[model samples]
Target: MSADRATTETAGLMDRMYRHQRHIYDASRKFYLLGRDQLIAELDPPPAGSILEIGCGTGRNLIKLARTYPDTQCYGLDVSAEMLATAGRSVARSGLSERIHLAQADATCFDAAALFGRDGFDRIVISYALSMIPPWRGVIAQALRTLTATGSLHIVDFGDQRGLPASFRVLLNRWLTLFHVTPRHDLPEAIAELSRIEGAESRTRRLLRGYAIHAVATRRAA
Candidate 1:
């Protein structure tokens, strides 16, 4: 299928899935969605720089980012209209509508210039979204392409759970399947390969007994 059609279909599916779930997403996800706040804290955007979050569900991270880095501009893109609606409301409630902009687009193939009137971002974050995207590698490549020189891309997602108990891993995998989420066991390898090809600096850490992985890749100096 064409990229547009695929994006539309994926958007529809996400909207259907989160039409109501968006309400309690943050509250419930707080338990297992580890390292998100760490990722946010580590995001030290340059003064007056721009930041974007792919698959910014409910705008929770964007709101925090706006509050934490008052000088930086924040933007977000999500395929789900339903989630965006919730995110918009959240941003407005947080009184950050002026600093935070949001749009609906596929993370794998979005035009940052058209959506946010910029060709690149100083900081881009993908939090727990890659595992759910079918074309996650494409998303990584796109993010790298849109990263400004000296910019960084941050990612946090489910790990292989190698350190977790076997029974727990089995149960978690089964639960994730219901939500259409898959842990990318090869994520570290993918990051290394991409960083090598793009001539960027890459770092990754496995946290919570290998339950989650956090990664950062910075653009190479020109």
Candidate 2:
């Protein structure tokens, strides 16, 4: 499918999926959305820097990052209005409405300069959002293109259940399928290809039996 069509489709899916789920999103998602805190803990944005989160659902990670690095400006973009509504409220409740900027845009093709008045960010993070996105690899490339020369991008998402028992893997995958989440088994290879093209470096770890936390894709200096 074309990028525009894919974006429309995904936006529709998200709108439908989260229209009601947004009300209880944070409450229910906290239980299974692992690796987010770890991603925040590991983010070390430069002093008085800028950070952006692609697929920043509910503004959760950006809120945490703003609190953790109060001096750094934070930005977020997502395709779903339903999700952004909750995100806006969350940012306000955290009293970070001024510190963080949220936008409704497709992660794969958004113009960072147009969205946030800049072409690059010091740090970029993507939580467990890639699995549900059909053009996620394009999102990674767009994200890399928007990174400062020395900035890094971090991503944590569902992984192949390579470490789990067959029965458990079957059950888990089935349950996740109900939510339209697919554990990308080829993620490491995708990252490797991206590294070669963008001169970025990546490291990934399997958590909870092959669920993955991938981080710190640093762009090479010019």
> Against the true structure, whose lDDT is highest?
1
Alpha-carbon RMSD to native, per candidate: 0.8, 1.3
Tens-digit per-residue lDDT, 93-203, candidate 2: 999888899999999899988888988999999998888887779888888888998999988887787887899888978888998998788887888788778988887
The 10-residue segment of model 1 with minimum total lDDT is 192-201
lDDT of model 1, residue 90: 93
TM-score of each: 0.98, 0.95
Q: Taking the candidates one at a time, how many backbone clashes does each contain?
A: 0, 0
How would you encode candidate 1's per-residue C-alpha lDDT over 62-98 as one tens digit per residue? 9999999999999999999999999999999999999
Q: Residue 177 CA error for candidate 2 (Å)?
A: 0.9
Cα TM-score of candidate 2: 0.95
- Tell me the lDDT of candidate 2: 0.87
Q: What TM-score quantifies how close candidate 1 is to the native fold?
A: 0.98
